[model samples]
Target: MSRVAIIGGGVIGGGWAARFLLNGWDVAVFDPAPDAARKIASVLDNASRSLPGIYDRALPAKGKLTFHDTIAAAVEGADWVQESVSERLDLKHAVYAEIVPALREGGFIASSTSGFKAVDLGAKGASVVVVHPFNPVYLLPLVELSGPADLRLRAEPVVRALGMYPLQMEVEIDAFIANRFQEAVWREALWMVRDGIATTGQIDAAIHMGFGLRWAQMGLFETYRIAGGEAGMASYLEQFGPSLSWPWSRLTDVPDLDDALVATIAAQSDKQAAGRSVPELERLRDDNLVAILRGLRQQGSGAGEVILAHEATLPEGGEIDGLPVTASRCVPVTWTDYNGHMNEAAYLELGSWATDGLMRIVGAGPDYIAAGKSFFTVDSRIRYLDEVQCGERLSVTTQVIAAEGKKMRLFHRIMTGDGLVATIETLLLHTDLTTRRSCPPEPEVAAALTRLARAHDGRIAEGCGGAVGERP
Candidate 1:
């Protein structure tokens, strides 16, 4: 229960606040604009919808939130302070001066500075660390930390406690990790357009349809390593190292921002974005990130690891409150078959989604699966009660049916928006993470199963465990 103070309430600051608050840290915020409250409200609205949708278990009760009229009041009891005021050095310096005296000695202060160096900012303080977090702070796991060597050890765990994976830079570098990598691409893209090598859309297409897919999963070095075959990283570097000297673009040089080039890029970007507003694009981006990351969580790879790490922190089965609800999506066209209905495989997919939700409730999830244990389907009895056609919306409700020793049974129903039952079923399981055998659940896990079982003890469907047709 550390108290976190978010010093500004713009998009980035509000995202930081959402991440900390949802993770169970009390948060206080200070923002001077009269519309600050409204702005943060909008940001949190999106966050509330987006954050909890990524997982099935409930988010920890959001830590209490308070708004402070002054900087001192906000930082008064804060154990960690995140300064996300405007990037101008003068503003940052003023904020540091205002809050420094109130910050407890050894209490951490991090500047979400995308470019400014902590040492160069010259803000005199007891301790300071540069914690450069990207936009959409709540979802992105990467945070690059740089400061004096001694301060890093103190900062790393604080970052981890906030549920971020911190990459400590041995030598402080400009813009840290992801941003620097982004800047390199940006510089090259600009050069390409300026030199008439490619249209704006073409460059984006090349990346998004090409290297971007590979980079998303494996990243630059590892991707190249895979390409190296049996030779490994050293061999890959040796073969490609010569190309580095013959580069078509200069990493160190800044591209000229000529009016003609700027207009061409801007017009192309406008076309690329269509008519979507900034907020619309932001929402779209978040939705895609959530869907992609959630899928990865199931596979136990990629950015899904962040979701998996979070799953480990959840309590086992119990009454959970304040979990945010996400928007529902229609079954994708790809899921439909020649018969114009969701294919048989997609039925199992929906059932798997239901299982993911149930597992989260019972404290078995990605991390647990990663640890070499998980609930695997031992038996299933599904009935297609009614027809569900392509493009139709679907929702499912899950209930624990029975629990005894290592085995438990779960029942679920898939329904249309109008409450027509399209499908119904029971799934029986003996979870086995290792050897993939039918093994009994661990005591803690069994206890969770038993509690869920008792909650719905008498409410079982017909043909399910002899508890006929009675549904809760």
Candidate 2:
């Protein structure tokens, strides 16, 4: 098992530990603070509940977590070392000095420093790269990386394996890319609050209710391109470029962090948040992010596309009784209806996924579809015997009912952690994509299907081969 050493137990450090631990990497954490362990545990609890919710598939079994008294102990035998100590240069350097001797030779080192450039971190002759991540690191997939190309290349696969997108910088600069843009907005917001132009809540509302939505999907340039209408980017620039000279923004001025300004911002923020605690707000943020990401998953755009691509690479489900556990997942909040139970359409969707799982089992997946031979469902019957609520775990088991020539029949049982929830029976016909007509599956697929069919011949579900009807 790979091991990572985390040198800090603050929010960012704890987030890093959670990300690594959840991804099946044994983690060693070293923090001198008194409540470091409890703090890390809190972060882990949030991460455990939120990170896996974003994916339809299960993450790897969690790795072992160990807390150490010193940086040397944490870095010992570790494959990777991540420093998230205080941003003070002396503190960071001191931590590095103690860790370098214990760090495994050839192992990678990363710093979660948002304010410092990679070059600055390496000035002490330590080979640390900036692997700066956003808050709730386990949920947000963007990690800004800056360092020597060799080190960046080594870190790319590791970061990507954690379901994060590593954006390698060509030139090192203070604050990096995302934060530079963020700083500009933050400075302007501070000025607005100082000048009494807008409250914190109103400023936040402006983003959350408007361009934030656009930025999440299309980003700035594409959003502007769309705003260009028929003419495109050049026309957009022609129309809006003059606004650059307008005094609409206060980018150059700095807001004094005085008592009154601080109090106003704090009071406004408190009012905006109402009575919700930090943990409550974190959960709210995570849920909204999950919904947005899932929506983008449908379009296969932006961060949603990243998740989709990552999902494609996840390990396939294991088997039960020789048949694959086709679909195992937590029913997302969006899948439930007003009654608080999973909707009718969701049953069919799960059943469809089970059918797709069967297709994969029989060697008829993406390549088969690309090769113009695929299964098309012609008939389906679903029996919802019990209700499943949001956040409940669900698993689907498939039984091959029959497989002969171009025709295949399958039955799926959808079970919750408590008991069986639903069953679906489907009849599918192999088809030639070009001709749009029934066609015999290739020999490999046919043989695999036949094998499964024979294995499940006498194991049919009770609700299989049933018609939709009311009890008399």
Model number with the top TM-score = 2
Of the candidates shown, which would achieve the greatest lDDT relative to the real structure?
2
TM-score of 1: 0.75
Query: How accurate locally, in lDDT, is each candidate?
Result: 0.74, 0.86
Clashing pairs in 2: none
What lDDT would candidate 1 get against the real structure? 0.74
**Candidate 1 lDDT, 1-472, residue by residue in tens:** 7799999988889889888887788989999988888887777766665666565455666788889999999999898899999989888888888888888866757888888887865556535688888778877767888887777777788777655778888887778778878999999888888888998889989997899878766788899998777999898888888888896676788788988888989998899899999899887777666666667777877767766786666543322122211113345444567886667777767777777777766777677778777777766766655566644556666667777766666766666657645334555566565576777776777888788777666663544543434443
Could you tell me the lDDT of residue 224 within candidate 2? 96
- lDDT by residue (tens digit), candidate 2, 94-209: 77788888878776579999989877777787888899999988788899999888999998898988888899998988989999999999999999999999999999999999
Give the lDDT of residue 236 in candidate 1: 86
- Model 1 spans > 4 angstroms off: 319-472
* C-alpha TM-score for every candidate: 0.75, 0.90
